[model samples]
Target: MNKKLIICALITFISLPNLADDETTLSGAELINNNCARCHNSRPVREFSISEWRVIMPHMREKAHLTGSEVKAILEFMEIASSPAQPVEVTLAKSLTVNPRDVLTRYGCQGCHQVQGAGGTLGPSLDNVISEKGRAFFLRKVKEPQFNNSSSAMPQMPITDDELEALAEFLSSI
Candidate 1:
């Protein structure tokens, strides 16, 4: 009777389905594709400042209706992706030098400032900033963002001199 009981117990245990460790966490790419890709491109696998990523990811998540875990996984994957030290390639896709058009879109400057017939209207028009302000004025305005309009709703832009020069040249060319 003991042997039979032991045999029955073993059979019951063997027939039971696994209850633990059945599921694995999703990969970042998978999470992004499943959630974010529906609305926007999975954030460019480029070196994004933590603030930049943080600023953008929430919007993407909100649009996609993704859960917190899904957002976290996608961000983790983006952080692991090998991107350039600077946003050089993304800025230089059109040419070796900066493309003003590209810069406007990449930084979402278009969302606020108007370029040569493009971009948003929340801020002043930059249609002729290249010609009107010139390089010196442009530099000052960009550097001292609060000089002209202390109450300007625009956020202080943080970019390097090289990027500034490239952007200026591109704008001037346009």
Candidate 2:
């Protein structure tokens, strides 16, 4: 009996990782495609954070008539998708074609102020703003332009947190 117990413990220990990896399969993808996509087109899983998803799922659950378990599965998938450690450079590179300048254009940022010789002159040039203000400050400004400065003319950019982070990373590099 002692020998049998030892063998069983070893087998279970060895199989734990395999079980975890198997659990990570595209179950979330299927749930999103079958349930979430019924109402609207599929969205990129990494677009929103887990906390945002927690808030959003309840609203969507009622609309889609999803059960609690379905919401849990979708949240699990998004948590993995938007994990902080996921390399942002891969997505940024794919979109920009290795040119950070495209972010400004894509976000309509070029129409306001010049940064590397493109954009309107209504706002101050961002030649050294990144260096001066730091990335966190820059992100705050982008998210809430008129937060502190009442006279600030910049509009609140309608962008996801992921895009804002990518834009900030690109801006800081420039």
Candidate 3:
């Protein structure tokens, strides 16, 4: 009985962090959908490039009086929403190894995204996105960001399958 209690407690503790992350992600999406649209027709994420978003977010953040987390969330959603789809490369290595953080930085993800509370405010936080959205979702988003949302402005990244897998795994662990 003591063992069972310990296991249950462990599970609960482990689960709470993920649950919090999911809530934050959802709230960010909801806030953008509900609030941004109230003032203006919610533009598709594809409406602006990442650089353009950089300029626009600060002004909008001040105007809306959005908190840091809210700004982070909005930026996160926008990064994914604005990415354009690209054809997957056929010449990738069978098991190309990669460092996810390095890849992210190399791709300038930090310019628009916040990971572990560090990065830009142009996109949503990537702290627990894999757990919240799943690896498949990240795979699709990385390869073809506009697959589900035609209006996505997220730029297509030229990454291999192995890199994608590494990134998904890294994000899941986060």
Candidate 4:
């Protein structure tokens, strides 16, 4: 019984660090989703460049009534999300298996754009934007958000081609 108790305690101790990490991650996403939507729609983490975010977060923190630690978590999440995309060599088979909705959530698309009667309102509702705009146009816009409008505020999303295709098709259907 004493040996079992020791092993259990050791296992719990080993898991504590991971539990903290999980809590922080969940809180960061949850804080943004819950708090930001109270007054205005939540912006996507990739909406601003890191430098831009550095300048913007303080003001937003005050406006959003976020604590320092809350802001830190959000900033960390933003920094991770805004980093340049690493090239991923996705095979055709892998691409075929990609879930479009997961891609959208991973990239925080719904933070700015509404889809299927849910999501934020910072950007246009995407329920029919893809169908209204051709798939080629949607693809170009996401790849280079400023392709047509040099002054557009939309950030270039760090997404793979497979993910983009999947998202486009998914959005088009909605």
Candidate 5:
């Protein structure tokens, strides 16, 4: 009986798509097609962040019989796919845990400040700042606008210190 059970178990394990010899580095679309499509139809992968996916993947993993490697590959694929596609801001090889342009858009910087010779006329254009000034100047201006210029009309942004640094870095590149 034990011999029979072992043979059956091996057969079942071999049948599972999550077996070690199966495809390991699946892309986001491939993962969805193979694992997620087993139960539900296509759903928007961009609807959730990687963190939210982390919270939700466990429930689906058990249901789908996904291995740990499969779950990790899928999560990475989704994170990269959902990230804003910008040459300077992102590359698929690097996980997009920190996208500066996303932060800039979130803070509505382009509403007033201009970059690359295009933006609202409300604030001064930042196109020349990188060439004329430096990163230090850019950082100070973003973190504490009034410090850079006492007569500056730009308001001090409510962004966190890291966000301010990222914004400064992005602007400096522009």
Candidate 6:
């Protein structure tokens, strides 16, 4: 009876899959692919921080309709499989100027600004303001808002002058 009990216990232990160490947990990449890759490719690992991941995961879960366990698996895979981050060139910040339309797209300027009477009414219509206001007034308003009209809810956009000028030009053209 004692020998049979020992054998049964040994068989059960051998049959069970051993989990990896608690510190360095193994991830299920196939589970991630099946669940995540259905909607969007795995974003570059460098593009997101842990905090960003936490924020984005819920939105992605809604998008992909992923369960809690699936999301955990995917996050684990990302944490374990993350490669060493590449050094971003600091000079790129000084050299690069984002296009005005891209800025508008990124910041959702049209959500408020009415270029040629097409955008939202939250703020003053930007239509013909480029031509009407002239470049100086436009630059000044963009760089330094003289007044935050209590009625108007315009968020100060963080950008450079060249970008502002480009935005002015883009708005005027529209």
Best-to-worst ranking by TM-score:
4, 3, 1, 2, 5, 6
Per-residue lDDT tens digits for candidate 3, residues 44-150, read: 77778878876887788877888878878777767655665443333323333478887888888878888888899877788877888877887888799799788
Best by TM-score: 4
lDDT minimum window of 10 residues, candidate 2: 86-95
lDDT of 2 at 136: 76
Worst 10 residues of 6 by lDDT: 86-95
Name the top lDDT candidate.
4
Candidate 6, 132-157: lDDT as tens digits? 77877777776656453544456667
**CA lDDT of 105 in candidate 6?**
75
RMSD to truth, every model: 22.5, 15.3, 22.1, 16.9, 16.7, 20.7
Per-residue CA lDDT of candidate 5, range 29-144, in tens? 57779879777777777788778999998778888888877788788767766776433221221213346777767878778877776567788777777668777787777778
In model 6, state the lDDT of residue 51.
66
Q: Name the regions of candidate 5 deviating beyond 4 angstroms.
A: 1-95
Residue-level error in angstroms, candidate 1, position 80? 18
Which residue pairs collide in model 5, if any? none
TM-score of each: 0.43, 0.42, 0.43, 0.46, 0.41, 0.40
> How far in Å is the alpha carbon of 8 misplaced in model 3?
46
Provide the lDDT at 53 for model 6. Answer: 76
Model 2, 1-174: lDDT tens per residue?
Answer: 556556766766664433246453356657789888876677776667678889999899988888887777778767766655422222223343334455677778878888877778888767667889777788889899998798998998777676776666676776
Q: For model 4, state the Cα shift of residue 162 in Å.
A: 0.4
Give me the runs in candidate 4 sitting further than 4 Å from their true place.
Answer: 1-96
lDDT of 2 at 25: 33
* Predicted candidate 6, C-alpha RMSD: 20.7
CA shift of 56, model 6, Å: 36
- Tell me the deviation in Å of residue 109 in model 3: 1.1
